[model samples]
Target: MPTGLVALLDDVAAIAKVAAASLDDIGVAAARAGTKSAGVVIDDAAVTPQYVTGFHPSRELPMIWKIAKGSFKNKLIFLLPAAVLLGQFAPFLIPIILILGGLFLCYEAAEKVLEWLHVDETTKHDEPAIVEGHGREEEMVSGAIRTDLILSAEIMAIALSEITDEVWWQQGIILAVIGIVITVGVYGAVALIVKMDDVGLHLATENEGVVAAFGRGLVAFMPKLLTTLSIVGTLAMAWVGGGLLVHNIAAVGWHGPEHLIEIISHPLLGLFPESAEMTVGGIAFALLSGILGVLVGAGIAPLVHRFFPHGAEANE
Candidate 1:
């Protein structure tokens, strides 16, 4: 009996070691994959609040909760299995799909820029009526969840493509971890962001000292921060999408666009001819990619509009 007990302990130790190693592997992959999809993460974080805008203060947290739950479903049930199959069968197709996702990101960024420039502000969806229906909260939550599914699809695809060499289960776990971490991080941030005013209002009304003054400042800063995040998110989306497009095009066959851009920026490198040889390539590449991204994005928007006239309604 003692010998049997020792064998059992030995087996348990081995299993524990394997589990620990698997977790470590998942952590490393998650970090690497998360980094690759950081741009979409920012865009996710940025765009989520727009969904919560005009909601009752009490409903904001609940709405975010509903979206977060849907986001988990997107990762676990849909994206995870799809990624596994893509990896197992049509590995080549992953990049093509990722490129398309990147193009979508670019289009969104360009649309934001156009709106910023007041070129087509009317095209941007105005906040729907804030008034609550009999079951408006459910409707809003459902809509937000559907939106998260699209963005989460992009995030998962990007992350899955980044996994270098791992088993299918390993990749799935890493992707799952990324989905949860990013969703929680983003929506958690959203909750804090959307509630700053409420928090400030409470603080200001309740506290009667320097605390009150700070609360007022918090209330004031929140709007500016939200605007800045939205603008930065737009640019990041464009830049990342453009970079992906350029690389994917090169990956396939045609490097014409990328090469042409490099040639265009080859002249404006730097004053120092010596340093220009080194850093000029990178700087030039980034600039050209960004410009191309904006152009590509702008081009796609009209096609999207032609297909889906009422963007808000279509999305709903």
Candidate 2:
């Protein structure tokens, strides 16, 4: 081969290798970021199906699709640039933003808890009801998206924190990947979860023998599963919200809550073998944070309802 031709081919090969390495780096970073946000991801999946609970079976998927689209918009359109810009220009504000989002989560969770306990009948009846159809669906979808905005912010913030060592553009790319992949993964799982009963019903009708029995079992289990998911979702909101507050509060220089959590969790950590201590300590801290979140929620809910009655009603 001619020398010039050989040199050109070598240069192209080197560029290709560089591109491949960059892609690999992005993949590894995105996965790492996604894993760090798994707790919030679980909370998101747990919380979402409840929104579709009272809707007709056929509307479930469509509603979920709408919410999923909104989730995409929340992460990509709104948050991705904001994360990159904020991380670059205003890193100090990230914690504060998380604190505010945490408060919103706590407030919502507290309201739900009150409703569950039948202690908030006045707020319940005061909520505006639209005639069933597009209006109600829009209301539910918007509410889900609003809740999702906070969760998505947490996810992106977590992901961005993981990738801060990368160059700015690389951080943006990794966040975009994490945003798309996690959103798809979360909402896809939710679709499967919400539609499992329908799947079971079809299986029960279309199959026979052991398959039919299993289908019947699935059908029987689904309602209970959904109910369990609702409860779990509520707890998850409190846990995640409170954890955010505890960690961010400490980040912003108030170590009191963090110290209290560590003190409380110390004995719990001691009960475990050394190998399991980290996991036990984490769980202990999470439980403590969740309790804090519940208290914060309870404290804020009444004030929010009193000062922002219409706003609170709209959330319901």
Candidate 3:
């Protein structure tokens, strides 16, 4: 009986080892693949702040909670299945969809710029109307979900492209990981950001010297921080959105932009030293892509707003 038990233990140990290895593989692949979606992920985090900016202090946390839940639904429930289906049924369609998403991002960013400068001569739309009444919460929640769908779709597509070596199950799991990780990270940061002022006020009133000083500083800094974040988010949206469209355009058979980038790189390569040259090329192309993307976005914004006022122009 003792000998038999020892053998069984050894067998269990071997199986456990295999299971652990498989899990490690999944973790590594997920991390690698998710990192590729960095651009969209940055844009997502940046854009999310605008959604939570206008609510009352008491309602802010609840509002963020509502949007965060909606974001999860967008990613896991809707996008995960759709991403798998796209990987299976119409692999070719993915690029097309991503390109369109990229365009939308660009348009949204450009519109934000236009609004900030008050160039369009429209009323203040940087903030959406607050829904009130019995149905108001539901309306706000639904609107958040609708907004999240667009952002989540962009995130998933970028993540999907990131998973180069995975089969369907592998890709699906990586995307799920990315979605959950990013959603939690974004909302968690947002919650902390929104509440800082309150936290600061409480601290400032406290008897403790250090805490009070920090609180005072936070109260002074909150507005500046939010303003900076808004600026960064808009710029990120333009650059990422433009980058996605340009890359996808090449993938879908337009060699013009890609070729032009290469040609531009060659000149920089001759002008710069070895290691720095590569970085120069990349930065230049990214700038080129961003500038072109803004132009493209500006051009398409009017048509899009006319046809689908809620498209990228949801403004909320």
Candidate 4:
């Protein structure tokens, strides 16, 4: 009996060790996947604030909560399963889907640019009015969720692509963890950002000295910050999307865009010290990719608009 009990304890200990190692693997994989999707995460963090702008301060958090819930649904209920099944059953389709998603991102970014330049007629109308009346909140939440779905799909796909050697269930778990972490991080940041002005106002009016000055600074800086984030988000979407297309094409033996990046980056390589060379090259590559993405998007926009005017804005 004593020997048998010892054997059972040893078996339990072994099981515990295996469980721990599996968890560690999942953590490392999740981090890698999350980092791979960072560009989209930034774009998401930047995109969400626009939804809350001009709303009543009281409604801001609630609206964000609603959006967060929708985002969770988008990732966990819809995207996660789809991504897992795609990887399991039809791996060849992965590249095609990624390319299509990248093109969609490019198209969305280009459409925004057109609107900014007044070349798109949709920019002329006022954004849907912010009202406390019935259905207004639902309209805003629904719109935000629709946009989140694409971004969430991209995030999950990017995450899924990075995970190798894991079983389908393991990959799904890693993706699920990633989805949850990103949604929390993005929405939490958005909540803090949209309310900073209110915080600043309170500090400015209710306090004094450095606190007041800081508050004043926060209030003044937010608009410029939002504007900058908007531009960055657009550029990031283009760069990431363009890079995806370029790399995937290279994977299949066409290397034009890849070679162009190396060519563009090569000259500057010698300009920087060895340590900074990689950084410089990366920037050069990203810049070229972004430019290409914008051009591709712009070229496609007219065709998309002619046939699918309504779909264009939704994709954007």
Candidate that scores best on TM-score: 4
- Residue-level lDDT for 171 in candidate 2: 87
**lDDT per residue as tens, model 4, 93-197:** 777777887888788778778778888765345664656843877877898999999899999887887884688988999999999999999999999989999
TM-scores, all candidates, are 0.87, 0.83, 0.86, 0.91
Candidate order, TM-score descending: 4, 1, 3, 2
lDDT of 3 at 150: 84
Off by over 4 Å in 4: 114-129, 208-210, 273-276, 314-316
lDDT of 1 by residue, 131-245 (tens): 6653777877787787788889888888887883788888878888898899889989999899999999889999989999989999999989998998788877887788889
* Pick by TM-score: 2 or 3, better one: 3
Worst 10 residues of 2 by lDDT: 122-131
Clash count for candidate 3 is: 0
Q: Per-residue lDDT of 1-316 in model 2, one digit per residue for the tens?
A: 6999999999999999999999999899989988867767877888788678778888989999999999999999999999999889878887888788789778877777888889877446532332358888898899999988878998998787678778889889999988888889989999999899988999899999999988999999987986777677778778878888988898999999889998888978777799999888888887888889888998998889789988888665
lDDT of 4 at 298: 84
Q: Which candidate wins on lDDT?
A: 4
Residues 36-97, candidate 3, lDDT per residue (tens digit)? 56666666666665665555677878888988998998899999999988887787887798
Whole-model lDDT for model 1 versus the true structure? 0.82
The list of candidate 1 runs beyond 4 A from truth reads: 1-22, 125-129, 264-284, 312-316
**Which residue pairs collide in model 4, if any?**
none
Regions of model 3 farther than 4 Å from truth: 1-22, 126-134, 208-210, 310-313
| Displacement of the residue 155 alpha carbon in candidate 2, Å | 2.4
